[model samples]
Target: MRHLTLLGGLVLGLAVAGGAQPMTAAPATTPLSAIAALRDPAGQVIGTATFRQMGQGVQVSVEARGLPPGGHGMHVHEYGRCTPGVDPATNTVVPFGGAGGHFDPGMSRNHDDPQAPNKYGHGGDLPMLNVGADGVGRATFTSDKVSLTGMNGVLNRSLVIHANPDDYKSDPSGMSGARLRCGIISRNGLTTRDYPLPGAQDFPEGVAYDARKGVIYTGSAVNGTIYAVDAASGAVSKFQEGGALGRRAALGLKVDPQGRLWIAGGAQGTVSILSPDGVTLKVLQTPDSPNPYINDLTLAPDGNVYVTDSTRPVIFRVDPDLTLTRWLDLGDTPVKYGPGINLNGIAATPDGRYLLAIQLNTGELWRIDLRSKAVQRVMGGLERGDGLLLDGRTLYVSRNAMQVVSKVSLSADYGSGQVVAEEPLRGLRFPATLAAVGGDLVVTQSQLDKLQGGTPETPFRLTRFRKF
Candidate 1:
């Protein structure tokens, strides 16, 4: 990953070179001493941040009193909970680890280079907070893209301190370690912001549903346990567990028309087929010829399964005999490496005539005619296109970079495309998969590995959207 200095001088140069108006740095108004104190669950004033309105942005100076001596990743997460005390059994902190991912206003892209020309991370990642041997560290930075006033006007979110530094572009969540400390970010003399969803709902991370049976199947990427959820009541039941699959990290779930549930085991690079009753489990390994970082899978109308490999940039077609064949190799696409193309999600049209795949590294969505094996660009200029689903005449695509979902209409020529809908997802973070259940759109937020730092409240979210 490339690291560009986000300094005031660079901001001016880029603005001028790009023929844009230069941004003026706003003067600090609120006194640093006037800022109110923020405390953790133990009632300790861990840090204090002074907020000032800037030119179309906000500058926040943060100072911590008793932080560990070193540099730490800091961010204003979406939620405000600061539950303390680690769990003795698991050595994990409680609700503190459950503060869902960053605050993604657009719901399109992932947490990467926010300065990228095309797609970037949201306005949550702040400058690295450093602590000295005296256990106090102070840093001042400006967010020209976002402000505390726009953060729901509450300015009462939590400032999460990560165990490790952030690489920034690691999707789902930054590779940063656990949440060491959390403090509620509040305005001077203002009350704390009220977070609507306190503790997250512990639903399945990646789920695929059977619209007919109203049954939802989910799997853990860490434990590899398959769970069955009653779609109507949201009751969870463990269907399958440890056998020969090692630690089953179920990435994608789909049910064939014949009532077979297909599970994409990401860790093992294999597919597990379960009977309609969710009793029997069958495993199929990837052929030796291809890279097997199985990310997403979908069943074609012909009863064969199409799976995507994130690392190899190829789509594999699996037959009943467990024979794997190359369905499409997308290495030839013109994609920029940084914001260009890395295959992540795969979906096919209802008739199985067209197949769509999302490039994670870029916002490019490719449409492939299964019959001709010809690929065409459908949509571009997205933040990070992750999950894709086709419903009726509209195609629903999840942009992990922008933190929003966009809909594109298919043209008669099959090559041209038009935007139908693009709406900001109010409370979604790194949504990884999209599915259609009985004409309704269902989405899952993988939350990736963000749970390690925060608590395991409800990292996996299942949301239903009605098409207008």
Candidate 2:
């Protein structure tokens, strides 16, 4: 079995042009500090705002980029939530409108100046953020209206950036045209929430989510035990027993458009497609190989599922009709399958024209034309890329060993891309693969290294990064 204990150093390319990389997370020892990662409606994190305790008030510092050049209103909202919802006032959908209104717990009811007395203005009101032509903005000031631990504290609330400038005297949000970006305030600064699994021997790898049922599914690497978790309630239950239906190891998983679960059997050279109720619909196998390691799988627009085999340098395609075939043999191409995990995560373009895959051993990204079976190296420097999720033109790669997720913005033609951001999955043991749910990213803490070095952590878990 190819144990996922491979830890290779990463070499990332320069960041995307004109984009502001997210700030490094603050030290956990920092006292009374909170951070909010402001993200746009597209769910891309554009900037961050940090708050620190200073005497009786809170010192606020905000930095953001990739925004329009103008004066934009910034403020703290009543709720910590940032999901889109219909505004009660307009009865129309608005981005970050779920955050409710300004932080006026004192019932000030007036949207006065930031310099105004606390009793005369909303506590959430902040000075207008002036963005430069380069699409960057920075502001720092102290606010006496909000504390970190007192009755008026804004912990777990939300910080929002508005589309237009604030007039400083208008009532109810100062005519801030629209909520462009918003982030939840948290003491540890990170928005990842942990969901505990059943036992310690799991060493889970692949992760998938059923949006219709709000349930998350992960498979055990130790013995192929499939576990299902309720996304809303964080409840854990067994979806499938280990070694069921001859599945020895579950490496990668995906919920197809039909809600069926497609699982990759590591070292077994098998792929299992199970119905929503855990019944085995079909089990497909690849050709006999000496060292076949079925690593990951992805669904395409054309109703076909493409999978990767890390050892044999080949890809497998499972057609919608349940037929399985060796789709593309990389041994015939320039992508030499050498030692280590060769191909790990796989993603396909929405148009189903190309398939993007990563080389774990060499840190190279390749694009394969579906029609011609031609392969081209699109980008490199993703050595430990484990799981991939493509949203629009953005490709997110989970660097398991690095404990970070690299955000890559692809070119219009999927021929080129650049790493725009790398966010650390704080407190995660070893993030393997990831799945997107709404605006959040649900990741598997594989902890494979621990399985190799020592005892795995008790009660394995999954992590959810809010609006990642």
Candidate 3:
């Protein structure tokens, strides 16, 4: 019998060719690394995985198609070949000769087992692949320990599917049954149809929620594309594609009390206000700056719009007359990147007496006293803080680094804070923005890479989380 090894403890056997059937060639000779696709004989893509470098670790996204509805186990295996059947007489199916054996570059063993814990196995063991009724499974995730540069490079190994779901801690096979499918990671980019639309190539630095219009607007970093998503149905539409603003890539989006959408074009140092109907109303140029790279903005209760320059660590107050005033200079915040303070997500208290800004690079959450302009760190060590929502005395923060959401109770002083909720929402992939409607939390899963079953590569996804 021919066998294949994969990430975790999965093993697969390929059926030998018989009669008119062609022999399953020794898994292709492609270099097993990078992002690649697995396709069926008919040239239909079955799945895809992308390997990325994050910090000192590796992040991979697997999306699959043409599977039974619901969840299925997925993992990287020890070997790359999938041979058919087994020799019952020996009671051993190829004995690791085919797939190899759990990828143990470190010679570690077992899953979450205290004996080995972090030592054994490669970073490819995954939970079941959840497919919708339409038989599509999509997911994005990261691993801090593995690399996908090449076979010996980390993913150069093999990938396999199991008959049963992985318990995540089982040794050998995790008690999961026979192997169902197998593939090898090749150096050349995997072939795949764009599943989910890739997120704006540049960072989606700022997001805004317009409750009355029930729409969300976000700015991209690369090309000038302003995304308008319907709050009711999560339908996304593009407005203003190829203009000066389009070329500049919008950054932050805010809604004025008068119900107009204001966008900061980071590339051009310009601000464009859009009507409720998604039409441009006016454009204002930022004064005293070249290439402002506007980061975050919020409308104050005092009827003025406050904008932050990500490149210079400065905040400007813009009046209705387009007059600009230097509100605060945050250059001394003990964190560098000056203008690029990596200052991204921003929000304000209902009373507008306090504003919250998240420093993405430093993972610091700062509360600014509007009156004194004093900035205090309310919390720090949050990963890739991207979105913020304030409801009553509670604050909701999205941590893209850890791929989770957290809720904290806010004190009048913005000091005594307590964590209220922190849980993973299933099927959430790279959540970048959030909106709350009538107690329900709406989140956007910008599936940023190809996974087992994501569509259009990195398509946008919406999920609802109910708060009790």
Write down the TM-score of every candidate. 0.60, 0.62, 0.58
Where in model 3 is the C-alpha error above 4 Å? 1-122, 125-159, 162-206, 242-247, 287-291, 332-341, 447-456
How accurate locally, in lDDT, is each candidate?
0.59, 0.80, 0.57
Better of 2 and 3 by lDDT: 2
Model 1 per-residue lDDT tens digits across residues 250-291: 777788887888877664777778888766556777766544
Better of 1 and 3 by lDDT: 1
Winning model by lDDT = 2
Candidate 3 lDDT, tens digit per residue, 282-378?
7776766665667557777777788767676777777887676777888776445633347766777778788887777776778888888877888
Tens-digit lDDT string for candidate 2 (1-468): 001121222122221111234334443334456789989988899899998766556789999888789999998887768989777668998999888888764556788888665567888888889999999999999877775543356766789999899999887888888899899887653345678887768988999999998989999987998988988779898998888889989999999878999899999999998899998888898989798899999999888999999999789999889899988888788799888899899999998899999888898899999999999999987767889989999998887765667778899989898876655544345678989877678888787866644345456788776433
| RMSD (CA, Å), each prediction | 12.4, 17.9, 15.7
lDDT of 3 at 200: 32
Off by over 4 Å in 2: 1-187
Instruction: Supply candidate 1's per-residue lDDT for 220.
Output: 64
